[model samples]
Target: MKVSIIMGAYNTAPTLPVSIESILQQTYKDWELIICDDCSKDNTYEVALSYAKNYSNIRVIRNEKNSRLAYSLNHCLQYAQGEYVARMDADDFCLPDRLAKQVAFLDTHPEFAVVGGGVMLFDGKVVKKTIFNPEEPKKEFLARGVPFFHPTIMMRKSVYDILEGYWVSDRTKRGQDYDMWFRFYAKGFRGYNLQEPLLRYHDSLSDYAKKSSWDMTWGATKTIWLGFRVCKMPLRFYPWVLKPIVSWLLPKKLIYIIHNKKHNGKEN
Candidate 1:
């Protein structure tokens, strides 16, 4: 399948090369890399241009004015010319077989519009944890707010064109991916999560505090609120009940342990 990989960047020079190299090493070669810069003050545009000049399949675009992440992604979309659209971030790396595996899964299961594989969180060099939600129907996935990581997802261009692309939400300035997935689920679309780790998600230590506490909270709240609304569940369940349990009763480390054990058992 021909795929258009879109990557939006803003001062991500430090990790941009790694992200690009990961794509270059992909087992699937029938793909185009679209990298667009959101008026970054750094040399992001220059780096992108250099790659574009070197690679025929790599296309680069830059905004004259700052447009942030959402707008930058839209800019990349305008240049996309593929049967499928895949999202990639400038700071994350995909496994060599990521595209091939996701494409194969989607081809075999034509009923599912979106397909994503497992993701491994990293702190630069060390692997911290893995995330994988069991494959389920659209309703269950949406109700649980268990999204297949955006970076690991491969979606048909038809899905985006049908959904009219990402939701430009005021609260989702940084959480647009989640918002989009929620909308897809609301529309009775199906999604799947492959069990093998196919992306190296960088949970860099430098931005942990802000990303986890502020950005993630804003995104998660938006997601859960929409899920509850769509599923007709009482909103109180999140804050009054589940939030407390997730925050205190269930520690993250413990959850990680349980998840790892389950995954290991499956492998055995």
Candidate 2:
């Protein structure tokens, strides 16, 4: 049983080598890496192709126009031929044993449709903090936030086919993974978290819990409402739909100061 890793690469030219090198250095050798470049402004496609030249298991694709992650992932899925499909971020670092461990768990446990692990949030210089999700997260967990980290997840290829892959629309432009999670549970599938950091996620402290723009935040709020309908969540959990709105309304400096204080135990 082979695992196919699909990644959407944008303007990550400088980080591509290290991220791809992590995949090459994986303890599990029976895997293929499918990277779909999303018409990046930089030479991300060229960087990916350079690796495909030497590694037969690595495949590279490119979109004709600049689409978002949702479209890029769906395009990559068209060429994925594996028992399991793993998600990766172009700028993240994977642990050597991440693939082997995930494959082993999925091989024995047939009930769970997806599995993900904790992630170490880091910038270029230092690890900021570790976010570990619960072991068995039920649908109600959506009331707060995502149960599993997106880039750390590996799922049965059938699940993707059954759920019809990530939702590609204006509503999902900012929160594709979250919408997919809502649909995943609504369809009666189960998921698990390994409770250990399996990847180093690239999240700068300055960008913590902050959307780049008001439009993005509003889009996320839209996604939350859409997810609420998909999950058939109770009205009691409705307040969470306004979380992005509230967070976005706050001053950026205040948001950063609060986030920096919580994580670093002191204000930035």
Candidate 3:
């Protein structure tokens, strides 16, 4: 089956080349990459266009204005013409067999609508590898946290058709992917995460600090509340909705230490 990889680029000029090169070197050749530049001020558009110019399967689009990631992804979806839709970030690189393995899993498991894999976290140098190996994730799992890595996920085209893409509201702006997973689970669409690491996720402690900001915490809380209502989850889970708020209060150094502990301090 053919897979359409959708990516949104903002100010990722520095890492765009590596990200695109990883896609070009994928073991699965039956795929097309549709990247939308979200009015990046840097040379991200030029770099992506350079690759598209040479590769027939790579297509580049640009937003007239500075649209965010959610809007940009939905725009790319309009031009996608493949059985499966995969998500990619301009700042991350994928393993050679990432697409091939994901495609095989989806083809064999008809019940699953989405599939993601483990990721290797890096910051200039390798940090730690996080593995998410869940056979089937349900609403209960989502109540606590997002079980699937957004950029490492691949889903059926029908899932997008049913979910109508990510919720593009001010409340869900930062946690759009989290909101979408809850909505999908509410609709009885199951997901799985492969144990193997198939992507390199690059970020620093500063990025985590920004992600744990009050605004982002509020957005995540709203997403959880929406999920509880839409999925009919128990009211007891309401407190868990505000769990991310606590993370915002923690020190950045502590957060990094906790994250490192989770991965057993193993560097790739």
**Candidate 2 per-residue lDDT over residues 1-268, each given as its tens digit:** 3899999999999999999999999999999999999999998989999999999999999999988999999999999999999999999999999999999999999999999998887778898778777788998888777888899999999999999999888767777898899999899999998878899989764655446587788888988888898889998999999988887888877776665445321111
Give the clashing residue pairs of candidate 2, or none.
none
The better candidate by lDDT, 1 or 3, is 3
Against the true structure, what is every candidate's RMSD? 4.0, 3.1, 2.2
Model 3 residue 220 CA deviation in Å: 1.5
**TM-score, one value per model:** 0.83, 0.93, 0.94
Global local distance difference test of model 3: 0.85
| Cα lDDT, all candidates | 0.75, 0.88, 0.85
Best by lDDT: 2
RMSD of 3: 2.2
Return whichever of 1 and 3 wins on TM-score. 3
Candidates, ranked, lDDT: 2, 3, 1
Per-residue lDDT of candidate 1, residues 1-268 (tens digit): 3899999999988889889999999999999999988888889888888899999999988888886677778788888888889999999999999989877888788999998877787778888777676665445444444467778888889888887887655556666776777677777788887888888887653543344454455555666677567655554455622442353344455554554555421231
Model 1: number of clashes?
A: 0
* Quality of model 2 by C-alpha lDDT: 0.88
